[model samples]
Target: MPRAPNEKAETAKQMYLEGQKMVDIAAALDIPEGTIRSWKNRYKWNATLQKDNRNVAKKCGAPVGNKNAAGGPPGNKKAEKFGFFSKYLPPETKEIFDAVQDADPIDLLWHQIQIQYAAIVRAQRIMYVEDQEDSTKVTSMESAGSEAYMVQMAWDKQASFLQAQSRAMKTLQGLFKQYDELLKSDLATEEQKARIDRLRAEIAKVEAENKERAGGEQPGDDGFLEALNGSAVEDWADED
Candidate 1:
C-alpha cells in the first residue's frame, strides 16, 4: 500500500503556495530549515507557485484588444523565458535553473570551492591507510559458483589516494584561480575577496608546514599529498 503523505509537509506546501519563504515556513512549523528545503525541492514548490501565479494572472488578465496592458510590463522577459523553460525542461532542472538564474558568478564559484574542498577532505578519511600491512579485498566478479576477488595492497591504495587527491587539488586550484580573476572584477564584494584570501592563506600555511617537515624542501606537483596527510587539513574541513 502507498504510504500517506506527511501532514506537516502538506501544511508547509500550503504556506509555500501562500508565498511564505522556506525559512519562515520552517520557523512557523518548527521544522528544520534543511527539511524545508528538501521538501521544497522534492515537491517542486517553486513550479507549483509559478503555476498558481500564472493561473491567477490568466483569470485577471487584461481585457481583449486593450493596448494599455501589453508586452508584459517594461523590459520584463522573465515570464516568457520561464514559460519556455517550464514547457521544455523537467521540473527538477527548471527548479535548479530558477535557483541560479540571478545568482552572482563569484558566489557560484565559492559554492563550487566549498563543495570541492569538502570532497577532498572527505576522501582522506575514506582512503586512509594505517600502514604497509593494511589492505582491502573486494569481490571483483561472481558467476555461478566461482568468484574473483581483487586485493588492493596498502601501497597501492595509498598511491591511488594520492593520485586522486592530486587531481582533486588541481581542480580546486583551478577554481581558486577563477575565483581570483572574478574577485579582480568590480562585481565581487570585499567580503567575498577576503574569504578566498583567508582560505588561500590557510592552505599555504599547511603546505609550508608540510614542506618544513620534509627537510624544508619544496617538492614538485604542489605538495598536495603532503598537505592531504597533515593534521591541519582536518581543521580546514571543519570550516565548511
Candidate 2:
C-alpha cells in the first residue's frame, strides 16, 4: 500500500516550517527542490519573510552562538553603539549573521576594533584631565615657562593619537569596501549580488548629485568637516 499524497505533503510542510531549506526538504522527501519550492509557493510553507524571525544562516547550517570561547564579560559597549547597521542589513544577510552568531570571525574583529576605539577615547580623556591638573598646579609655580613646555608635549601626543585614529578609520573603511566587493565577487548569494550592485549605482548617482549641487564652488574645508561630522557612518556598524 502506498502513502496518501496529502500525507507526504504534510511531512514536507512540517520540515519546511522547521527551517529546512527547500533542497534539503526535497531530498528528505525524495523530491526535487523545484517541486518543494512549488509546494512552498502554493502553500506558503516558508512564509516568514521578516529577517528577525529566522535563524541566522550559516554555510554549514549550525546553531547560533556556539563559539569555543569561555564566557567572561557580559558585552562590549562601544560595539553596541553601532547597533543601527545591524537593523538595516538585508534579511538574508542577517540570517547569516544569526547563523554564525558569536563564532563569526568578522563579528569578533568588529568588536575588537570597538575596544580599540574605546581605549583611544579613554586616552584622550586622560590627557585632557592631566593638562587641566597641570594648569592648576602651574598657578602656584614660580616658573610659567615649564607649564607651557609640558602642555605643548601633551598636546603633541594627543594630536598624534588623533591623527593615527583618523588614518586607521580611513584604512578600515577601505578594507570594508574591498570586503563588500569580495563578498559580491566570491560569496554573495544571487539576491545579495543584485542588491549590492543596485546600491553601488545609487551611491554613484548620489555622489554625482552632490557634485552638481556644489557646482562652481567645491566644498570648503569647513563644509567638508561639517559633512564628515554629520555623516550617518557614525551610526553604522563596522560590518563592512
**Which model scores highest in lDDT?**
1
Please give the range of 10 consecutive residues that has the lowest summed lDDT in model 2: 220-229
Model 1 RMSD in angstroms: 12.4
lDDT of each: 0.73, 0.49
Tens-digit lDDT track of model 2 for 51-168: 4255444235445876635443677532222233333555477556556665634434444544544553454455442442233222334474553322345546545545554554
Off by over 4 Å in 1: 1-80, 204-222, 225-240
Provide the clash count, candidate 2: 6
Candidate number achieving the greatest TM-score relative to the actual structure: 1
Clashes of 1: 0
Candidate 2: C-alpha RMSD to true structure equals: 19.3
The per-residue C-alpha lDDT of model 1 at residue 129 equals 82
lDDT of 1 by residue, 1-240 (tens): 999999999988987785566666665565787998999899898998898788877876667887864555787854444345645666577668778988998999999988998998787678878778998999999999999999999989877876777677667767877988998897789999898767767767766786778776443323454443343344333323
User: Model 2: runs farther than 4 Å from truth?
Assistant: 1-105, 120-124, 127-158, 185-240
